[model samples]
Target chain A: MNGNGKKKRIGVFVCHCGVNIAGVVDVERVAKALEGYSGVSFSTHYIYMCSEPGQNMILETIREEKLDSIIVAACSPTLHEKTFQSVIELAGLNPYQVEIANIREQDSWVHSDKEKATLKAIKIVKSMVEKVLQNESLEPIRVGVTRRALVIGAGISGIQSALDIADHGYEVLLVEKNPSIGGHMIQLSETFPTLDCSQCIMTPKMVEASRHPNIRILTYHEVESISGYVGNFKVKIRKKPRFVDPDKCTMCADCEDVCPQIVSDEFNMGLSFRKAIYLPFPQAVPGTYTLDIENCLGLLPIRCGKCKEVCEPDAINYDDQETVFEEEVGAVVVSTGYDLYDLNHLGEFGGEKYEDVINGLEFERILSASGPTGGEVRRPSDGKVPKNVVFIQCCGSRDPENHNPYCSKICCMYTSKHAMLYKHHVPDGNATVFYIDVRTGGKNFEEFYQRTIDEDQVLYVRGKVSKVYKEGDKIIVWGVDTLTGRKIEMEADLVVLAMSMVQTDGVNELLKKLRISSDANGWLSEAHPKLRPVESLNAGFYLAGCAHGPKDIPETVSQASAAVAKVGDLFAQEQLLHEPTVVPVDEDLCSGCGICVTICPYSARELDKEKGVVKVNEVLCEGCGACAAACPSGAAQQRNQTDDQIFSMVRAILRG
Target chain B: MRIRNREKPFGIEKPVTARGQIVIIEDRCKGCGFCIEYCPNDVLRLSDKYNSKGYHPPYVAHEEECVDCGFCQMNCPDFAIFSVEVESGEREPAPAESVKR
Candidate 1:
């Protein structure tokens, strides 16, 4: 089916992959079995088909046998599909003409019997050969790249990724669903190990990012929808109303002074109160105030406009409405970060009922210099400095029966830090940390953890707290120290729980809008666990920071930088070349019933009203074959995964 | 179908023209001394004077021995200090008499 009217010559290469495949499956017999296949003009086995000599042998055989197509029966396509595809391309064949049969993971590794594994390998190879015979020589898809990137979340991760992309000389649109751009880092008193003041380092970067020429900060905005493919993506963002104009506001705090409505401040983790119309924090970037319309008296029915009356700049606009706009970007970096697991179900812990008991972040706010207690480390009940404090680790984490099965990675270290901070402020304070095991794997993290025990004289109890109840004025904690085998009773003034972390709110809706998938726990799924950590399965989309999983600041920053590097590499090319193995529409067979249009998750298929047929957007189709499977007329067929090609492969495999 | 960079591009390599000196913004330093601890070369030490935040900021203890590794800058969560490579002429020569010490 090439230019010449001659029978296509195809070669099948089977790789031993060392003991990986050769240990169980008979590779030699699998190659010999493919020799009788009609399209397989050449068949051979190599020790390592991905090595230099193995590739040379393939190149020599292809040239000698005049083969136009190749079938690589080897490991999973995720591992070697690109390798063999490039090898075929180097041998003057279209890359699409190279088909990969995943015999290692699908056949050999999964099956126990050698005879059956070899037979299954032969069938997979034969199926790939049939699929390759039907493959048309395809040109790489070339589409113009927008040369711009979108970064969601204004946390340290999003900020770092945006700064990296902007430094690479490309435009970046950083969107945050908050009033300010600091994310959760700004709420911390200090970073662990180094003990450097968090705001002293974070604020400058936030200021620099707001002033960056290539970076546009869109605070108080959420991504509404995402469309198009890798090289070019069309995104719609809904910018919520921020009554105070950022440009006109001077951050004078006059609006906050006059506003009578007091609400629980989210920045301080509800450890303090802020006026209904106020800035999130003193060092909030853009230095702008946002009106919490839900709680503000000035919004609903216009009850009180005292702040508007006192404002000299008249920055407050009561007529502000949510505005939606679109942006074209070449890539997207997701760093939406995480939220703490709610401890409402744990009645024994008293986290929900007790006023003195708080989570780690709430404790962080209580120790913050700008917090309500002014860094006093006081009990929330009576605003008095507590003499005794208890810090519990792995609350609702790593407990399969009660809570999340996975360890919230930061709890061990942060709980130690909280105890240390409490000891630092409350010099003579009795601080006890109850933990299952102390996990300190980061650089110098173990040293920081040890210092809390030896240097600070903090007590470490290897146990789980069974119950916490208020007995008179003191809170009594009951638990058994597993190491000492002693049932202990401790009465503490305050208790801090290191709660588990989960995906932030509204992330599921965002995932649906982006068409990206998540794991069983709702964490974003990476393309591969080790090979491709930052990239999602959907091309042009990247993940950074805790959005993927629980990670520390250093790990989050490194991953953010990696995500930007991917975006920069994609932006480096003016036109991106995608794999041409996408779906093609058959106008003659299409029923114009709009089934394919509805079935396509990528929005690639559309019903043409004029032609009475379903049209395919070649660039958008990812070749998932979902539309093909759902198509009643069999018109929505993938390029190489057609019904005839698939039927022949099935028949050939079953007959073998 | 093959195209390569035909002309020289700009800003490819950040010009290391600050002659390998660590600049400490005194006010920003929270006295964590991470720069001193993580510095590969023994170029920095805690200063005797306290900053506005009541923390001892770090200072260049051995300027001549510095190699501009930037470990101090990277490790400093406070963004209090950073290393910059400067032009050779812009840097002052160490005293010839004290060079032996």
Candidate 2:
């Protein structure tokens, strides 16, 4: 009860939601039914409860009715809970006294029978009225900040976020599951619209992050576990062992010369070979050589020690073990990047059988000056220059029954870039592109596509490729040209499949450890797609780059910088305020069985051995109600949502 | 809570063997061949028949000679094959077709 309570006065407001609710539910009937409710002193109905006049009506009623609490029967609380709360607070009343019953989404929109739906709306409103009478006006709790940030997946997005946060004078930890800091961006020859060299633009940023005073980079490391929330979080990282010691060895070629083990080079998209003890590339950040223990034959039981035997500095450690460590930070930015469409899933395109068929990234490697063929448009089957090359767009995209249904936004522009680059390499070669639709939705991108068609003399055919096979040192592509209404078959020297981008493997497990929810399509969920696009639903966590979905370089960088701005906003506050709805322990009812201690995910509840009871860390509790649900003796009860209040609410709803 | 105990079953027909066996889900194989390359006992080889994905899945050529060093299980990039250890004195060996589905 309130301080000077003489029978608490409550008001109930019903909304039509502009035919969204009134089309099915009778809002006038709902307000009339609640007019004589037990605690309700006033009842009214409005056309739009979220508009300016509707809010003014609520504010004036709170003053005239002397109401201590108000229940708004409107749409879902996720839309208008804060709006009504602010209206009451503006009228010199407590914000917690406003209860919103979601009648539109939960009752009216889902049902067709108007008679039953209006009764259901009345029941839902009555339950809210019962719950509001028992609520207490509580203040938010204030906690201190840790003033540090962690960025996962040292890709282009991660690098940008780390640089932005470090420039804001806060310490940052950058963790990557690769040997180098640069992501897939460094593997490309050039970007679209501007035709700028990818490595030339990426190398400077990698060097700057490595030399930054406030940034600490941990390559070949992955997040193992995460704890706490918002301003205070603890993270555990697992570091894979690199057999060569970084401090003792120089970036030299002596180790690679002596290593006998050979493996496909991932940096070149497996188009080339490298020794087991080689660097990812020459311009790799940190400029250190890493020995892959998985492919190296010298690690287990010491079968071969050729690299260690020839090392002048004795830097090789065959006894290296994987290490696990921890770090504490106030905020997190996820930028795990993406993977190319698996060639295993594209077997129809002969990506696995024929050597001439390649993906977009592999074509990038071939066009690079440092790539396998040294910037020559030679077919992978043999080192012969191709006379005609075919580009197939949307290989595994926009096919709902078999593959991803969404369009890979970058394919059309990148395919245009590929055709122009191939034309520049082989002047007499003909370039044909089979596309579903030419989607150029970025700045200057449509103009770039037109320039490529006019200057490069590239053939654009609107169609889909049905099958691709190898025949007599040439690749045969069978497709249908929708514009001409005819089936067409052609022979080409090389075939490049513009495959779709997919989420990186094993990132779902990391998200589960952090308790973040992913969408049905497997991308990370944003707080709100329009209002709060950079934030994760959880407080103090942020999303960036392709981790949210597929996007281009400029959009990914903008999101990364925006995520850093949110983290900077967090660090600006001296003490952060948290929800005061945490659970409290009842010493009289606790059995000291330690069940609540083991069930809380936040580690908020602990058993007191001396007192034979359980104690709660009020600030750490998030009011998830796990401890209350698992308690055997009813010791852990929520602040506002209690068993007595819930029983009364059930009675009120059941009365109808 | 009440605790319950059960009586052990007797007179079961089974082979008494100490060797381990490996099972393969043919459709899941991408034919990376990392398993066949890493097998310490030379127990596996690439199959001639193609799975639904048109990639050659591996088969156990020397099943009787498998020591189950687990090198293939640990090294398979596609996770298409796994090894099951046999207890010293129980259980019947499952047929290859029985495990494929």
Candidate 3:
């Protein structure tokens, strides 16, 4: 099998994997069959091929028999390819000198007939042996890692991740889109289950993050672009103009008082009014005031300089322009959180058009102690407490036809919390909740939902609110209770729609910048659903909070901590040794067609204009084989999974 | 199911001779009480004194009973509190550790 016409010395090791593979495939028979193969100088079967003794047997045979190539017939290559690769490398053989044949997940588990299974294992082993005969040595690419982390979004998840990374003595740049550091968590009244005040727990972390020497806060900024590989990421951030000096503007209301222009306060969900110059919230991390350039008359040619004149610190600057800056970091944590589904599109709900009908976030603002009503449950239609409050769950969720089919994980529990908070505000008030199903899948979440029904005396109806229309002074909700098989009509002063959670804005643009894939619904896809849940397929990037999926505060915090730990593990090392499983382009064979450059998702390929060929950035190549498949010429080829190796296996499989 | 009480039983402060000291990194403690919850011998409690960040850091309430297991340090997310072991037989003044904060 050697190219020099000398017989190749090869070894084959079969694994029992206890009963997983041994139960179906006859391991000794397969070993005996492979021992007679043309180039196999040594063959053996072990109880566990990945075990220390099993690996030792292969290493000993390699040294004793002078074996140049090795084939392992075990579980899928994904399960133990790296383990076997390291074993071969330790035995002074090239890592690429080894090949794995799928005998368990591909053969034994799929076939019931013992005869066919054993026969199939032999063919798979023969294919790998042929492939291993042509294997060449490969060395891993090492790159230096910057021990700094950039966390996008200053929500609870991002705040937690940034703080955790900073605690590990790594510098962190926490960037937020809004004028303030706190994200949606700052607007929440009280979290579910424990009922701990969200701001009470959140603001302390925000303040600590602001004061921490290792952490830097970047409010009112967005990630413009991201480039480079895992250990060295170059990020461009766009700093939106605040029109006020962040350092000089104290949390004083002087400018706010003097400003003649008034605008809807976004932090209050547009239910409250604030001057053109205002802070996002009272407990904002930086404690700085931002002037709304769009609404401020002073910024226009009208020459209204009232706010500038009254500013004690002279913070007002109408000429403030947006600035873009670049940063270099080793890793990034995306905790972009989530935005509520627009209930205005759901015409049946009569939300946004009607004053009394509101979304969950607006209700959260109403329940907040620092809100416009001062924690009072006052209806927006009239500044009076509503006696009858109704909540509808799954408004735009789990509806495949017109809305998102996936469950908005937090709606059920939060709706229950909303109902409970309503009852707490008005003891005599009647609280009713209409839900498709109650999904409380978190620690103490179910108990919290039950407490609202049992202890708080909130009525739970298992039904979908078909229609909510304003009739006279009350919003009439019509639906049918499925459990009782009867139609029910309820009149309510206030209606709260638990809107479905959607991915944060500018996700597609951010995804393009980060060079990562997202699911159809726009949630960031993890590397693996189970093993690598916190990490993205692209190295150095991590996902946290609702950005990955819908999750509660505790889960979000835990995930953020997990992401920080991952970043810390990466930062602990001086440099990263990337897998050598990248495709290399044979420049002579490449046509300079630029097909590979366009096909590569990682942007690892480029057409060399001078040479009239294509070049591959080995460090950036992810070895997805997309370019290899798209190449008209067989120039673009992966190192381990080359066209020849794959074709050899395919031919062997199809031989019989 | 009812609303589960999030807090564990608050430990009582008992007088003890000092065997070890748990240094409370004041600003780092978010008062999560993970250390108190994981302490095998119940040697720590949320301090009455507040840090600049307003979080009650975990303090050595029963220093004599402490075995220096380091479970508190291992479980702390913020790495705010860590146990510093002293000589097994070392005897120190009583109640001085309480007022040190």
Q: Which candidate is the best by TM-score?
A: 1
What does fnat come to for each candidate?
0.00, 0.00, 0.00
State how far residue A88 of model 1 sits from its true place (Å): 2.8
Candidate 2 residues lying further than 4 Å off, grouped into runs, are: A1-6, A11-67, A90-92, A101-126, A309-314, A583-587, A590-633, A654-656, B1-101
Q: How does each model score on TM-score?
A: 0.82, 0.79, 0.81
Model 3 clash pairs? none
Q: Give the least accurate 10-residue stretch of model 3 chain A, judged by summed lDDT.
A: A295-304
The DockQ-derived docking category for candidate 1 is incorrect
Question: Which candidate has the top score in DockQ?
Answer: 2
Question: Which of the numbered candidates is closest to the native, going by highest lDDT?
Answer: 2
Pairs of residues clashing in candidate 1: B17-B85, B17-B86, B17-B87, B18-B85, B18-B86, B19-B85, B19-B86
User: Candidate 2 lDDT, tens digit per residue, A1-656?
Assistant: 44456567999999999999998999999999999788888999999989999999999999988888899999988788989988999999888888899999998889999999999999999998888888888788888899999999888999999999999999999999898999988989999989999999999999999999999999988889888878898899998988778778787778776554445567877666566788899998767789876665534532446577778889888878899998999999999998877766876786567777888988998888878777776776566888999999998889878989878789999999999999999888999999999999999999999988999999999999999987898889999999999999999988999988888888888898787778866789999989999999888899999988889899999999999999999999999987787889999999899998999987888889999999998888889999888888888888778777789899999998
State the fnat of candidate 2 relative to the true structure: 0.00
- Tens-place lDDT digits, model 3, residues B1-101: 01111111111111122245677787988999988976645678887988888888878888776645466777789998887767444222122112111
Which residue pairs in model 2 clash with each other? Answer: none
Q: Where does the lowest 10-residue lDDT sum fall in candidate 2 chain A? A: A295-304
Give the Å shift of residue A528 in candidate 2. 2.6
- Each model's backbone clash number: 7, 0, 0
How do the residues A1-656 of candidate 1 rate in per-residue lDDT, one tens digit apiece?
A: 44365677899999999988888889999889889687788999999999999999988898999999998888988788888888888999888888888889998788889888888888889878877777788788889989999999989999999999999999999999989998888889888988888898899889989989999999999999998889789999999999889999988877776554444567867555555688988888878999888666435422456678778899999999999999999899999999888767678987467777778888888888877677878876667789999988999888989788888899889988888999999899999999999999999999999999999999999999999999888999999999989998999999999988888888878887787889877789999899899999999999999989898898999999999888888888878876676777788988899988888888988989999998888888878888888888988778777898889788877877
Report the lDDT of model 1 for residue A466.
97
